[model samples]
Target: MEKMTLPDWMKEAPTAVCPASSGKERKGFLDRSLRNFASVLKRAFASGKTKDGPMQNLEPRAKLAGFFLLILAAALFESWIFILALLVMTVCLSAMTKAGAAPLLVRALPAIVFTAVMAAPAVFSFVTPGAPLAGVGGLTITAEGVSTALFFVLRVSAIAALAALLVLTTAEADFFRGLGRLLPGFFSAALFFTFKYCLILVKTAEGAALARKSRTIDSRGVKEAQRWFASRAAFILKKSLNTAEEVSMAMVSRGFEGRVATAPAGPLGFAEYLWLGASSFFFFLSFGF
Candidate 1:
């Protein structure tokens, strides 16, 4: 290979230009992460604000009831066709919400990929009638085992879709509204603000990671990269913990009483009753399959 030459200025770099050994960038990253994490937590504890047309009218209790019913129905289903149909149905229903089903699917694709990777091996591990593939690790793999794996994939996908539907359709404040009605007196039911802060924490974590990446030098090798990543992670974790404590104290100082209670769903009007019945009927038809 021919020798490559750099511009004259490139070879005359000063020794004083070396990176700071005291890790100022790393310290700055931790500080920024801590501040952001605290802010994120504050926002997360705040109740979800936006609401769309249909979701605005429904009682909080009604939405919660419907959600639990749907989850129960999905869980009871076993057939591949039934599970597939339910997943489609969830996406279809999700369209009525402002967030819509498409966005939900996009957000959930990561979990879908993970589930597929994890479940693929399990399918071929056990033998059943009409085995499709050979067994792994001493067990006889069969067509039945493979199909069973696929069945689980469909099952989880459907469940995830339904959960997504609830997120799009349900308001964060009313989440507690529903929870308070469903499980009154349960301490977990009183965690609406906790959920709010949790979102903040997630945002803080992301911000910290991005800030770290922007400031830190790229490592040269695989092992060095791993160490670099771990160091950054530890920094984030420490900052996040400190941030969380500050947030908790701030909330306590602000008179945040931890209790969630959904106002009762008053007697359903004729239209509300009709729609509720319709939803139940459609859900049952899907459930029966």
Candidate 2:
């Protein structure tokens, strides 16, 4: 049998030269990417059996209700002081949860930064008319604009921190169960499955990237790399569809009927009642003050 050989034109083609990256550089890039991905996964799925975390012992429904109440307060208030107070409460509660402030802040940093960036434009007099605080040519920073931006940032930060704290302390299943109680049956199931699949997709992408990095020995041109990535993305999309179908079939086989049913919530304790009352009072107070 004759062995396969390159065509005459391909055999005669000139080898293209590509800029070479050091193995160390490639390894460093891969490590940083993987570490970031891992951190996101860790933060998203954080749930521990802490002995005395602030949110650890609360019923899921109670925690969910409290979170929404505080979030509503945060949203409705325009006062920077109130927003700061909420931020402090969130930080203090998170500390009591024993989930390490550093990790929580790190995980929430992206959202915080994004919110700040999005709100930064509002600080200019052009976007928000008010008394000028400072100016460079026609671009003036107004006092009212500054206050609005600060309030926006603080409100967003508080809400994000509260959400992170809740998710970190509460088990994912319990959180979903609590959410299921509030939402319609089909919507609850969809939300749960959507979030579940999103994580799976992230994991799948990470694995694919690592595999590609392991096999890659030489640096390629930007065009080649882009093409490869596009192909890989298409492959992942196809794979995800197949996986989703399989999951749906498996769930149906196990008696899933587009509804997520969780165990009935138990009676609220004294502590839960107190927490609810305090949250309600604060929420209402935000309106008056």
Of the candidates shown, which would achieve the greatest lDDT relative to the real structure?
Answer: 2
Q: How accurate is candidate 2 locally (lDDT)?
A: 0.77
Over 172-205, each residue of candidate 2 has an lDDT whose tens digit, in order, gives 7777777877766678778877877877777777
**Candidate 1 per-residue C-alpha lDDT over 117-219 given as tens digits, one digit per residue, 9 for 90 to 100:** 9877665534345645665577666777677778877777877777766665666766666677667645544375456556655665667556545654543
lDDT of each: 0.64, 0.77
* Models, CA RMSD each: 8.4, 7.4
| C-alpha lDDT of candidate 1 relative to the true structure | 0.64
Q: Which stretch of 10 consecutive residues in model 2 shows the poorest summed lDDT? A: 15-24
Error of 1 at 91 (Å): 1.5
Per-prediction TM-score: 0.60, 0.78
State the lDDT at 6 in candidate 1. 94
